[model samples]
Target: MIMVTGASGALGSLIAAKLAASGREVVAGTRRPTGSARRVDFDAPDSLAEAFGGVDVLVAVSAGFAEDDVVIARHRAVVEAAANAGVRQVVYTSLTGAGEHMSIAPAHRATERLLAAAPFAVTVLRNGLYAELLSQAAEQAVATGVLTLPLGGGKVAAAAREDLAEAAARVAVEADAQVDNAHRGRVYELVGSEALGGEDLASALSAEHGKEIAYAPLSLGDFRAALTAAGLPPFQVAHTVSVFANVNAGFMGGTESDLPGLLAGAPRRAIDVL
Candidate 1:
């Protein structure tokens, strides 16, 4: 049996539905159980073992967007529960290697270490930045006729979220069927083929909207001040700033990947999602 944690999330829900469509025996693990979904709250560790019981393979989605300590603690609890429940293998969604300089990378790195040391076999899916995130910026640019960001001249190799979800589903199903799993102890870098910059975004917007759009750069200090004035939490502001800094420093774009090999056909273009 295959179990997908964080099933209520966008990526997790896509993976679970794909597995079910393929006729796999899949279970959805969520905090709020609806229909046949099971409650698998990372905050409540005591209930995890029962939630993971009789699971042959566990697809552990990253529990993210929290403080570093909180993220680490939740991952530790999940690891313990999966081990206690006798799960044979675990597949984890992790940050791309290009994001090593980002503020959120440490927790993901720590989780990778924990999974590596676990008793069960593990597969690490190092997913890239989501193109869907850039769609918001595109929309804002279309409205204002200018694409403004702190990215400077840097480019991001953003993959479609649906492509990443499909890759995860395929890996989990293949792992469950293999006697000697080839995916065990392997890390797949799932980055997009094209690296998109500010000008590229403006061009795409212009073509889609049939109007001239321009790219405008913002200084990090001004961006930080705006975020602070907007009443964002200190950690979120810091994390957001870190992403811009990393991208500007050329740490978030790469050409090599295992994404195409995992899929049945060519991966979807980033523009399709935008």
Candidate 2:
């Protein structure tokens, strides 16, 4: 049996559905799952064990927003449960360049380190930034004809969420088929073919919307002020600024990657996502 945690979430739900449609025995793990899905909460140990029981492969998606320590602890619980459940192959959905000093890297890096010590084999999917993440900003840009953010001139290597979900599903099914531990301790950086900047994004958006959209770079301070003025809470404002800083430093950009091959063809562009 293959179990996909966070099945209520965007990527997780997609992965679970795809795996099941592919004729794999899939168990959906979520806090509140419908239909035949099981309820699994990282904070609940017994629930983790129950959800993971009899599972041969485990796909552990990253926990939702929490403090760094809390996130790590929750993931530890999942790892322990997977071990106790006798899962053979573990697949983790991690952020791209998570080993680096990006804002969201610590928890993911810590989880990867923990999984390294597990008795089971693990495959890490270093997924790139999601293109749908920029939809809100893109909608605002379309409304105002300006793509204003604090990205500066840095590029972003982003892929569609559905594409990432498909790759994760494939990894799970293939691991089940082989079960030879060939992917043990292996990591794949799944990203888009092209490294995109704000200008490139604006062009894609303009082409999709049939209008003239301009890229307007803003200072970090101005960006924070804009976010605050837009009614974001302090914590969210801080987190958003930190992510932009990482983008400014080129943390999200990559020139060449195996994403196209992983997708079995050319990955969709920003225009398709828009």
Candidate 3:
């Protein structure tokens, strides 16, 4: 059986659904039992053990970003449970530039390490930034006619969440015979074909919405204040600001083969998604 953890999440839910629709024996793992999914919580080891029984392939999605330590601990719990259950392989949804000192990098890097050292074969799918953010930015721009963020001249090679979910589904179903053994214990950076800067993003939004959208680059302090004013928690504000900083430092942009290879076609452009 193939198990997709974090089934309630945006990406995980899609992956589980896709795998199920494709006729795979899918077990959706969530914190609550909804429909066909089994209830499994990271803080609850018994739940994990119960949910993981008889599972062959495991799709381990990252925990919620409520806290870094909490996320890492939850990921570790999943790794331990997978190891104990004798899962054959694990496909992890990690972040791009996970070891590059970004805001959420440490937890992802640590989780990758834990998965790598596990008895099972591990595939680390380092997903790029989501284009859904750009979609949201477009909506905000429609209201204000300005796309404002702390990202300076840097760019993000982002793909839609659905694209990543499709990749995860394939990873879950493809067997060792179909996939090369060399891909095991390797990291695949999933990214879009092209990088998008703020101006480029604004242009896309303007074209899509038929509005005079403008890109407003803010100071880091200003960006944090904006997020704070928007009622984001202190930790989230910090995390978001740090992400923008990394974007400025060029950590979020890359042209990689894994994403297009997984899709068997070019990923949907950010503007199209917007």
**Candidate with the greatest lDDT versus the true structure:** 1
Weakest 10 consecutive residues of candidate 1 by summed lDDT = 174-183
Q: Per-residue lDDT for 75-145 in model 1, tens only?
A: 99999999999999999999999999999999999999999999999999999988887777788999999
Two-way TM-score contest, 1 vs 3, winner: 1
lDDT of each residue in 128-188, candidate 3, tens digit only: 7888866666788879999986779988887889899998887777842345565567788
Instruction: Give candidate 2's error at residue 167 in angstroms.
Output: 0.9
Stretches > 4 Å off in candidate 2: 179-181, 226-236
CA lDDT of each prediction against the hidden true structure: 0.91, 0.84, 0.82
Which digits, one per residue and each the tens of the lDDT, describe model 2 over residues 67-99?
778789999999999999899989999978722
RMSD after CA superposition, every candidate: 1.2, 2.0, 1.9
Runs in model 3 with CA error above 4 Å? 176-182
Q: Estimate each model's TM-score.
A: 0.97, 0.92, 0.93
Q: After aligning candidate 2 to the native by TM-score, how far in Å is the CA of 258 from where it should be?
A: 2.7
Point out the higher-scoring one by TM-score: 1 or 2: 1
lDDT of 2 at 203: 90
Candidate 2: what lDDT? 0.84
Pitting candidate 2 against candidate 3, the one with the higher TM-score is 3
Q: Which 10-residue window in model 2 sums to the lowest lDDT?
A: 95-104
Steric overlap count per candidate:
0, 0, 0
